[model samples]
Target: MDTLTCHPCPLDAAELARAGRDDPATGALGEELAARHLVADGCDLVARNWRLYAGELRGELDLIGVDTAEGCVVVCEVKARRDASRFGGALSAVPPRKAAKIRALTAAFLREARLPYPRVRLDVIAVDLGRDPVLHHVLAAL
Candidate 1:
C-alpha cells in the first residue's frame, strides 16, 4: 500500500479555459492535476489516458503509474466534476460496473505491456472543482 498526501492548489477555471482551447470541460485539467499529485507522492507515472481494446472489450485508464517504494503498478481512474453535489462527489461516481471494467482493463494492460510488477493495485483520483477544489486519492479502491 502507498500513503497519499493532500495538497492545496485550487485550479483557476478562467486560466484553464484559456490554456486549452480544445477541451471545453474541466476533465483534462483534472487528469493533469491528478498526475501531478501522483508524482509528488513519489510515484513514477508510466502512461496517461491509456486505452486498450481486446476484441469487444474496450476501456481507458486515466493514469498508470509505478509506486517506486511499493514496486507495484497502480492503475488510477480519475473523475473530475465542477460540482459534486449532484452526483455525490466524484469518488462516488465510479459504481461497481465501472470498477469491474477498470479491473478488466488493467488486466489487458498487463498482458499487452508485459509489466513485471509483483503487485497491481486499482486506485481512484477524484478531482472536485467546486468552491474548494480538492484532489482526493483512494488507494486500492477495488
Candidate 2:
C-alpha cells in the first residue's frame, strides 16, 4: 500500500459512526474467523462484540474468548484486505485511539457482565478474504 491508501481511518466521529455500522458485518466475519482460528489453537469462545454502558459511555468489544488454560477475554478488531501488504493490510486499521475505545469496552464488559478473568488482552486479526482466506493473528497489538 502507498501513502494515500495506507493512511489510517479518520478517528473523528464520522469514521467511528461508519465503523460502528460496518463493524457488524466486517467485524462479525473477522471475529467469527478469529474464534475459529483461536479454537484451532485451543481457545474457547466466550463472547462477541462485548459491550458495556456506563451512563453515557459506551464500549464495544469485538471478541471475548478464552485461550488455553488461562481465563482470557480476547478483545479483537478485524481488518480484511484483498491483497496482503508487507506490514499487512488492516493491520494499521486499528490505531491507538481506536484501540483505547476497545480497551475501555473490554473493561466495561468485565464490569457489566461480572465475568472473572485472570488476564485480559487484545488481538487484531488481519485477513485477506479474496480467493483464499488468509489470516494473520497479531496478539496484544496494543
Candidate 3:
C-alpha cells in the first residue's frame, strides 16, 4: 500500500497566508488541518493533492484517505475561505457540478492507478479562517 505522510513546516496561518501572496494561506493550512483531522478520525492518508488529467479534463482531489474503520476510500474536497460569511462557508462552495466532477475524478484515479475500486465516498472539509481556524467535516457529503 502506498501512503504519503505530511510533514508540515511549522508556520501559523497568518504567516502561511503572507507567504502565499498569490493564493490564500488558509488553503494550505486547511488541508493540513483536514489531514490531521482525518487521522484522528481513524483514516490513513493515501494521497494529498492528487492530480490527474485526461485530454482536456483535469481534476485534483485535495486529500485522499482510506477510512479503515469504515472500509472505504474517502475522497475529500477541501474548501477554505477567510470567513464563513464570505460565501456561505466551505460546504456551499461544492456545488452540484463540482461534486459530479469529483465523482468522475475518483473513478478515473482508481482506474489510472490500477487499484481495486474500494467502496468510495466523497467528503467535504470546510475551513473557516477566522481568528482561530475552525473545520467542519461532512462525510458522504455529496
Please report the candidate that would top lDDT against the real structure. Answer: 1
Q: Is candidate 2 or candidate 3 better by TM-score?
A: 3
Q: What's the lDDT for all of these models?
A: 0.80, 0.61, 0.73
TM-score of each: 0.85, 0.67, 0.79
For residue 80, what is the lDDT in candidate 1? 78
Q: For model 2, how does the per-residue alpha-carbon lDDT over 29-112 read when each residue is reduced to its tens digit?
A: 555566667676677777776566667668676666776576666666767654444435667677889888887777777776
Tens-digit lDDT track of model 1 for 1-142: 6445455656676844533344345678778888988898888999998997659789799999999698899999988777777657777888989999999898888888887888888988888776677788888733
Estimate candidate 3's alpha-carbon lDDT, on a 0 to 1 scale. Answer: 0.73
Task: Rank all candidate structures by their TM-score, best first, as comma-separated numbers.
Answer: 1, 3, 2
Q: After superposition, how far is residue 15 of candidate 1 from its true place, in Å?
A: 4.6
CA shift at 80, candidate 2, in angstroms? 2.0
- When summed lDDT is taken over every stretch of 10 residues in candidate 2, the lowest stretch is 1-10
> Each model's number of backbone clashes?
0, 0, 0
